[model samples]
Target: MLYQSFREYAQGAAKIGIGLGVISILARWVTGITIFASPEALVKYGIFGGIGYALMGAIALMAFGWLGKRVRKEFGDGLTIGDFFQFKLHRVGYWMMIAILLITSIEGLFTQGMAAGVLVNILFGIPISIGMLCFFLFCVVYVGFGGIVLIQRLAFVQVICMFAAAILIPLYFFIAKGVENVYQGIRLYHPYLLVLNNHEGLFFMCTGLFIGFGQVFVDQATWQRLYMLEGKKIVPTFLLSGLIWATVPLAFSSLIMVVIFTGSFNNIYSLLFDLIRKIDTIFLLVLFVLCSFGAVTSAFGAGLHSMISLIAGNVYPLLKPDANERQKMRMGYMLAIAIGVLSIVLTFFFTPTLLELLFFFGIIYAALIVPLLFIVFSKGKVDNFIPLCALIGLVAGYTSRYKLGNLDAVWVSMMVSSLLVIVHWGSKFIKKQLGNH
Candidate 1:
């Protein structure tokens, strides 16, 4: 079921039709971070902030639909984002992109692994180490052994669990406690949540748009799915997936309101635990656990699979052009297992708050967005300076963070990259005009 042949194993079966395409994207994007991050936004920046969080993701995914169309029109036969970079970039630029993508993808896995540890610890009272090990092992087995087909099948089931929880959990809370009580409770205890005109919230929304655009635009997993889908289905699948995916963060944010209405908690996980206590039904509890676990695992699996694809498709081939299909498949499996182990180790040692982690990496996403966009839209191969632009932006962004703060650093990063690209293109345009004269 996983592989039709070695070729299929290397580059999926290309059998993810429209319906499966939507669900698979949904499963990948509707992540554990969304479950917690939406509520955290609401609590920190008010209602608008929460709405902004959902809007950023929805808009990003929808925007990718347009990019997907371009991708198919330009290079429909590509297997991975690495393939696109290989074609669009010089050797140095391609390697830079590959390295950046690998770092970010590893970070993605680490985040999901952390979320998995938290979920298992919360739900089953298991130690985080044991929980993380189990989660990593599960992903390694299925994704490493079964490839894209297995991941796609599991994605469908995971998405079903997510939708069930997103719809039912919030609805049940509203019915049981009543919206009026929830609203009144927020008014009495956390009135900031009700405020509509939060300037900070607006700032966050704008900056978040930059971060979101950068993230989805460069995500190898999203690009992999684009290749997996039928050519005609690409835009509609992403557009519909974005629309459906928005509801998840919206619903989960509302659920957070229900928890805070009762009382404030020490932290996000505590709030989650309190919400679990409020749900009197055992079935709902089980559903919530399944939903949370599924989200984490699905996301981790997607990241792992994409990383494997990038290595096998781009890195390994360059290293050993003589390697056969079976050899490539074996390398992918080994990489998956190695990544799983590394992710577990990292998750155990590092424990930053979710938003902190996001903002820290926000610098990279901000820096990458402009160059990646220029690469995609440019008619011909881009110069080596494009990747160098990203590198400089990253340096400037991080340097500015201590003085200006995280959000400002993101703006600086984006501005620096955009400025560099614009100047280079303009200079070239002027040179061409002078030559014509």
Candidate 2:
């Protein structure tokens, strides 16, 4: 955990092994938000809704593996997504992206904070503010100040506990309750969940790809894993991580099912209450609580640490080229505390549902996916105008949001950005052909 250089602090003392990397990523992705949101998705759009949601994230992570191999090959010594974008983009484009990234990063911490707040309140009867204060302080003190070195070490232990809970609790539930009885109960009460040919579910799955692509692509936390591993391990580590992560939602969704099968619930909130009640055995109950809490802790820590890394490794250098390593590290510690406090305040005030948060951010994710893909796949530095497409699409999408609804607005944003990119490339090709003639 000891490190002198800012690089060492932001990344690690050296590269990590595949096993550590995969577990660290699992810790990073399977957040309390993921635990809460998965079950909610199952309730909203039926069984496929939950599966599609998991598929979106899994596909994104797996595809990131394929794309990241190319990224690391060309840009091997990167520290954060900020570094990569700065290298690829002009000053304007880079700053624009930094703004977008900053928003998404905060939004990410917000979700975790909200989930953690609710979790503690339910489990321990703690007030939301007190719970959030403890959550934020812990993350900043340990993961934030300790940096990647401590994060990786702690991630190994946390991920192990998560997988243990994910496996054992569900197995116990199914075994005790009987799978056949559970299935019969579900069919008798919530029959739509059993239906396969759900058109809304299929549409949701398809649109989810755009959000997933941009989310994984622009994620600073995921990018940290890319550079923190052995060069040869990049693809397989991420590929394996995605496969492992996909199982998390399934396990969580099943945990909720244990409650759902007993009788009808009023809504997702009541279902959560019932799920908590259903954890009858003390061992199973402790396992479930720890798993959910660990999910929040790991995700929050990864996010807070990565944001600190971005500021220390990239932003500080951009602003003050003369800053020494000690100064950069100091700034990072301060920034971590600041960011954690900001997340606490925001999470306390913003009371949107997880789905609302997803759709709200979906505009940004959808808009950026295509342009970012083009930027990565292209040779050398490209136009700053490429990044502008995201801005235009974002404005267009938000404007249409009230009229078109949040979900459809996401599609509009993606479509607008995709068309712009096509035109940009098409015009470039035409100009090149004319010059050749």
Question: What is candidate 2's TM-score against the reference?
Answer: 0.96
Candidate 2 global CA lDDT score:
0.84
lDDT of 2 by residue, 1-437 (tens): 56777788778777987888898888889898788888888887888878988998899999999889888877887889988888788899888888888788888887888888878877778976679888888887787457777777777777878888889989998999999999998999888988899887777778777888888888899999888889888888999989999998988888887898867878676677678888888987887888888889888888988888888877887889999888887787787677677878876677776767887898999999888988888888869888899988888899999998887888999999889999999999999999999
- Where is model 2 more than 4 Å wrong at Cα? none
- Worst 10-residue lDDT window, candidate 2: 347-356
TM-score on alpha carbons, each prediction: 0.96, 0.96
Pairs that collide, model 2: none
Show the lowest summed lDDT stretch of 10 residues, model 1.
Answer: 1-10
Q: Which regions in candidate 1 have their CA more than 4 angstroms from the true location? A: 1-6
Task: Quote model 1's TM-score.
Answer: 0.96
Best by lDDT: 1
Query: For model 1, how does the per-residue alpha-carbon lDDT over 1-437 read when each residue is reduced to its tens digit?
Result: 44655547545755567898899899899898888777888888898878889988899999999998898799987888999999899999999998889879877987787788877887778877788898888888878787777787889889989999999999999999999999999999999887777898889899989988988999999998888888888888989988998889899999988888976679987887787888899999889988988898888888888888888888888999999866887787787678667867876677776766778888999999989889999988999999989988988999999999998999999999989999988999999999999
